[model samples]
Target: MAMGKTPGSSDDEGDSAGFAEINITPLTDVMLVLLIIFMVTSTVITQQGPGGGTKTGLKVNLPKGGSADVTARTTDISVAVLADGRFVLAGNVVAEAELKQAFDKAKEQNPDTVVIVQADEGVSHGTVVQVMELAKQAGLGQLAIGVREGN
Candidate 1:
């Protein structure tokens, strides 16, 4: 009797070969998901505007100037000086002495901590300077004046 080869059967050598084509469906799906995530996050960040999204909820008329934008950092301290002469440190109303103590504590935690002072346009120059001076005295060398970007 003669031996016959069956359909879909390999030769007696028992060699098997796999498809060389690569499947990219999973890769494409991952890349699309990552792209969507990045787009959503970027939109959220831009909507938050500058000041690192640290909303102190104290609305102050920021003086418009041609100063460069300062990127706020988490390690930075934000102090708001209202026109009524009250100081809001990190969203809490604090006296000048308390503000100084906060600055000192911040300096102790991180010598490179930056102090961002946002004073109302009606606030006296002396008041703003006082805040800056306190920050300087606390050994926090980095200081920034918050201002709206305009002419």
Candidate 2:
């Protein structure tokens, strides 16, 4: 089982057997690297929005009704994610491919904009993530997930 030594290679008589040793150090190293990477990413993604390094120029609609009313701050920009994964920027429906350009323009205009992510109940989580990435790329700082008051 030692390196540079093969039991069967010596005796071509075809009746020799050699055991192999499995080293797990490489696997362990890879796993540790992955863990460290995830840990760093976790720390980096602890928050969302403009002050959070993500653009907030969306004025998406919120799901109707809740335990109470959510006070809409005049200073915040609302970005809504529809059930079909469309982005609503500033009370307007922004095309999927056009989102980045729109966000870029918004970012150029206002760097302190606050973003509100209002996802429809039926929308997939992936859709939200895509929009969030776009927001981050736009260099926004304050990001908010608009949640209605719980009953």
Candidate 3:
């Protein structure tokens, strides 16, 4: 008896069989989901800083200066001296002793971190100098005084 040719069979002399092509749709979908997850988490992380301190946006009337303007870095630590002589660090009211600890922690994390003292116009010069000295003792070299632009 003669063997008959089968449809889609490798034995067929004139026919060729090959593996099916791979489908990447599922892989693409998984990658897109992961990307979206990372984007959402990163936004939440930036909203809350390392110590969970958000900018208090404290109102302080900065002293005016005529010197050349310099753009402040976002990484710079802000030490706000209110007109009432209260020290606000990282948006929280901090005592003089706590100020030094905060500066030390910041310097330990980044040795080049700059301390920017934003003292109100009514704040005493001595208070501002006190914060600067504390920052200097914390091993931080860069220090800046926040001032308003224009005269």
Cα RMSD, each candidate: 7.4, 14.6, 7.6
Top lDDT hit: 1
lDDT of 1 by residue, 1-151 (tens): 1135444457656643434357999999999999999999887666444442345766889899877577777778888889988998766789989988988988888898888888899999999999999999999889988888896
- Least lDDT summed over 10 consecutive residues: which range in candidate 1? 1-10
As a TM-score, model 1 comes out at 0.63
Cα RMSD, model 1: 7.4
lDDT of 1: 0.80
Model 1, residue 53: displacement in angstroms? 7.4
The deviation in Å at residue 1 for candidate 1 is 57
Q: Candidate 2 — which residues are off by over 4 angstroms? A: 1-75
lDDT of 3 by residue, 1-151 (tens): 1245444556535554344357899999999999999999887666443351323367789888867354555566888899999998766889999999988888878887878888999999899999999999999889888887865
Best by TM-score: 1
Residue 69's lDDT within candidate 3 is: 53
Q: List the residue pairs that clash in candidate 1.
A: none
TM-score pick, better of 1 and 2: 1
User: Model 3, residue 129: what's the lDDT?
Assistant: 93
